[model samples]
Target: MAVVDGEGEAGLLELEDDEPLEDEPEESFDAEVPLAEEPESFGLASARASFR
Candidate 1:
């Protein structure tokens, strides 16, 4: 089994601080990429197949 740890909590705080600066743009790109996959998984199988 995998062990869950407090390191993730620390990382969350760091992200909350970084969010005020360049994190917005960085997250936007990251969000967009996953968003694209999400739609493909939901109903756009054709697009997902193309990407693969």
Candidate 2:
């Protein structure tokens, strides 16, 4: 008959070959990426003039 020590020796050995700790750098966004500009048709200045 085998004895089981409550310390969980078998389970800990399975996770022994894991990855090491290290710092990962952040990702950068380039300014050259094109974005569409808003049109002047829905201008806020003209909308406020109508509310007064």
Candidate 3:
């Protein structure tokens, strides 16, 4: 329900159906929640954190 924008929403949509995320909905939700609430800046931060 927190999916608010096209980019954040699209990432979740793309990853949501992947077999790797089949049971990891919470992970995606957590990442996307902040993305929806914050600006694109936070989205970039989250991406960097994810890579770290």
lDDT of each: 0.73, 0.41, 0.77
Backbone clash tally for model 3? 0
Instruction: Write down the TM-score for model 3.
Output: 0.32
Candidate 2 per-residue C-alpha lDDT over 25-49 given as tens digits, one digit per residue, 9 for 90 to 100: 1111223222212234345666878
- Tens digit of per-residue lDDT, candidate 3, span 1-52: 4456656866677666686667789888988988687877788899999999
Model 1's C-alpha root-mean-square deviation from the true structure amounts to: 8.5
The regions of model 1 sitting more than 4 angstroms off are: 1-23, 44-52
Per-model TM-score, in order, reads 0.31, 0.21, 0.32
Top-lDDT structure, candidate number: 3
Clashing pairs in 2: none
Candidate 2, position 46, lDDT: 68
* Residue 5 lDDT, candidate 1, scale 0-100: 85
Between candidates 1 and 3, the one scoring higher on lDDT is 3
lDDT agreement of model 3 with the native: 0.77
Candidate 3 segments exceeding 4 Å error: 1-20, 39-52
